[model samples]
Target: MKQFTSIAALTGLISLANAHGFVTSPTARMPGDAMASACGQQVEVNQQSDNYGNIQGELQVASGQSDYSASECDIWLCKGYKFADNKDNVYSYTAGQTVDFTVDIRAPHTGVANVSVVETSSNSVIGSPLISWSVYASTATGVTANETDFSVTMPDDLGSKCSTAGDCVLQWYWYAESIDQTYESCVDFTLGGSGSSSGSGSGSSSSSSSSSSSSTAKAETTPAAVETTSAAVETTAAAAETTTAAPVETTPAAPVQYATTTFATQARQSAEPSVEVQTASAVETTGSSVVSTKPIPTDGTAQEKLNFVESILKYLAN
Candidate 1:
């Protein structure tokens, strides 16, 4: 356990060094996080914070940022995540009020940023984030930081829950587009008034900060052979059934067509030869299994015969 604790401490320090910047203004003040909190120290000008150090950016909720847990996150990079912390420790503000979260831009890497709200009640992402585009850096204002701002609105949907929990968490995530990295920071605060009629009418808004995360969330694949072939068999069978019966005597007969299946294709189909399907037993055993389908003939007795074959195939498929 001692070994694990040391390793975890080392890892947190490493992440802080790499991620590169944090909430400079409206300084993120977490009780367990900052040592100054022990002495009840309010922030003073010219005094540097004891929060995070430079670290990498480009974190996706699915990957980089720490998950919203029922447990408190005492570790450094967990976005000041805490649960059931003392209410006296939190800062207060109005719910549904738009607030600008200032970020200290340390690195020159071009990136996009977002500020969001996570409702403590559900531990879910509540609404639209205040996002900015290819936000570049600027000159420092007081020997403090090269400042850029992310305007965040405490969602009105939070309602009286602000007073209920007496605290809500604000998350700031910056994804470095060029660099495949992410940086995040969080703040805890309370609302002044009820959030009942404040946010956009929509219940919940999705996080659109990282397109990479969006693409990862949506994944599609080619359908399995069984799914494709089974549906095909049913469709071919149905199409065949609609054919009008044609007399063999008047039919211009054509040899039946067959497609040679490779070992892989055969393995995928896992079906028997067409001859097996001729029997009623085989038809009953396989529900509309595909045996090669013939091309639909354009005209004449051949067309009628083609239709007749279709009907037979459809019956076997069923």
Candidate 2:
């Protein structure tokens, strides 16, 4: 029993030496009964002794324990910290709110790190990371001011995804790739309010675009309607001109033909009356006496007719 106790103490010391970092501010989740039931009592006790230890060390302790259930523990996420144990420590935040973070680095190991909003149930990142560092806490370069002290702004887009206390967490993830060690600490948070101003801005843009499109449609339709009406008006005017031209052409033709026939008949009648008067007075002309005579029929040329009338006029004068 004494030998076993000695070995255990030495193993604990080794694990502590290997562990590098943990979140110091904002009261990160700690091991409790809920964690022990899922991760095995030994693994829970191991973390209770040194909560700053890495996930690799916890897995080492869990390997020999029959009670550890990997599926239930989900140690890869937040080092299997249970929300039930940290219920009282949950944070309430509004969208676009900024939160300050402080991490204590007991030992330096060059690594990559990020802080993100994570959904607790599915272990999925809610969105892009709030902040990240490609190189962090290098042994040679040492930890920097930005690495240990920083702030992350809550996302504007998470409307109700994190309204409940246990639904989500602000997770700090650090992986020392060279050493193959990973450490995680989670801060429980519940978002308040409907959403952020950015969401409202997007909606306003959509409405403006819709209004502009509608105006454009109306503007296009008006020109087409005017063009159609103009075309119809031009067609009607052309048809009216064509209809009026037909009556003018037909009416003039009939009047010209009738006038020509009437003028010829009057000329013939006048010539006959003069011929009759001259013939009737031809035998009685010497002694101032008058005699009636019938007009003779003649189909003479135009000059002959003129000569015949002139001869009669001279005889009547004598």
Candidate 3:
């Protein structure tokens, strides 16, 4: 009877292992890249394995420039397990399994910057899960900041694993800071099922490896039309001055001279040129300057008058 009980116990253990299948593996190691703009950068989770399969996740970034003297970063894992929760201190999964993931990082300043991720799965209390990473600077700015998001698939063979589902956990570490600053901010991920699991071993699994982002904020400055109007007015005034007409000068003609003669004789000899020439001396000299003045049109406002004057001057100058 005792031998029969032992066989039954062994059978139960084997059945439980088969029901749990294999724990999903965490993503692979990703190198850090630089952020060169105030807008920040995005880093993708790139670990995967065929044995455990792929998982989706998302990342969110916010600036504390006004609240914090230095920049700080926080990463939230909406799904999966964390390294700290696992006994091995590193993500654990069945051998030969693969998991796919992605992350995004943003920069707060212009020029090149570096970012990195670390993985740890051993000696739970002594070391962090980070093993390898990539680093480089971003090359853009403002809305164009050197931010980018990428993804990769990695094999779960990077670390060891446990025998049951509750024994393992997955964790992530992320950082984004200026190369010039000594302080760097980091974020981690924790793992848990998306509330669909029942203890019976028969349940549904959802993807927790994708990310979604909200729209950017609108600009706060005024429109361009106001500036354009001011520029146009100034240009018109300048053109008017350049096109104004120059003043004209006039000279009075010299008085005419005539031979000495009487008015009565001149009248009687109007038909005779010689007599008319002699009679001209009797006429008195009259001086006059022909100063002609035309009324300036005043029907329009000052601006209209200015515009009109400007047009006339421009025509004359041309």
Residue range 1-318, candidate 2, lDDT tens digits:
896476467547756776688987666788999999999977787787788899998888888779999999999889998987877666555566556788998888889999999998999998899999999888889999999998777787987898767888889999988688899999876666533322211111111222322222112121112222333223244432422111121333242121122123311112232221224334433332333344433787878767666656665586
Expressed as tens digits, the lDDT of each residue in 24-122 for candidate 1 is 544444334242232122210001222343222112111222332213332223343333333333444444444555676555555666666656555
Task: Give the root-mean-square deviation of each candidate in angstroms.
Answer: 22.2, 38.9, 33.5
Candidate with the greatest lDDT versus the true structure: 2
lDDT of 3 by residue, 1-318 (tens): 896456345434433322211212223222122111111221111111111111211111123122211122122221222323222222322222222322333323323322222232321321333222333222243322222332222223333233233233233332223333111222222222222111211111112111111110011111111222333223244432421222234585563332323221211213332211111111112112221122334887889767656544544354
- lDDT values for all models: 0.42, 0.69, 0.26
Q: Identify the leading candidate in terms of TM-score.
A: 2
lDDT of 2: 0.69
Candidate 2 lDDT trough over 10 residues, lowest sum: 200-209
Candidate 3: misplaced stretches above 4 Å? 1-94, 106-133, 136-170, 177-318
lDDT for model 1, please.
0.42
After superposing candidate 2 on the true structure, give the runs of residues whose Cα lies further than 4 Å from its correct spot.
Answer: 1-11, 194-318
Candidate 2 matches the true fold with a TM-score of: 0.59
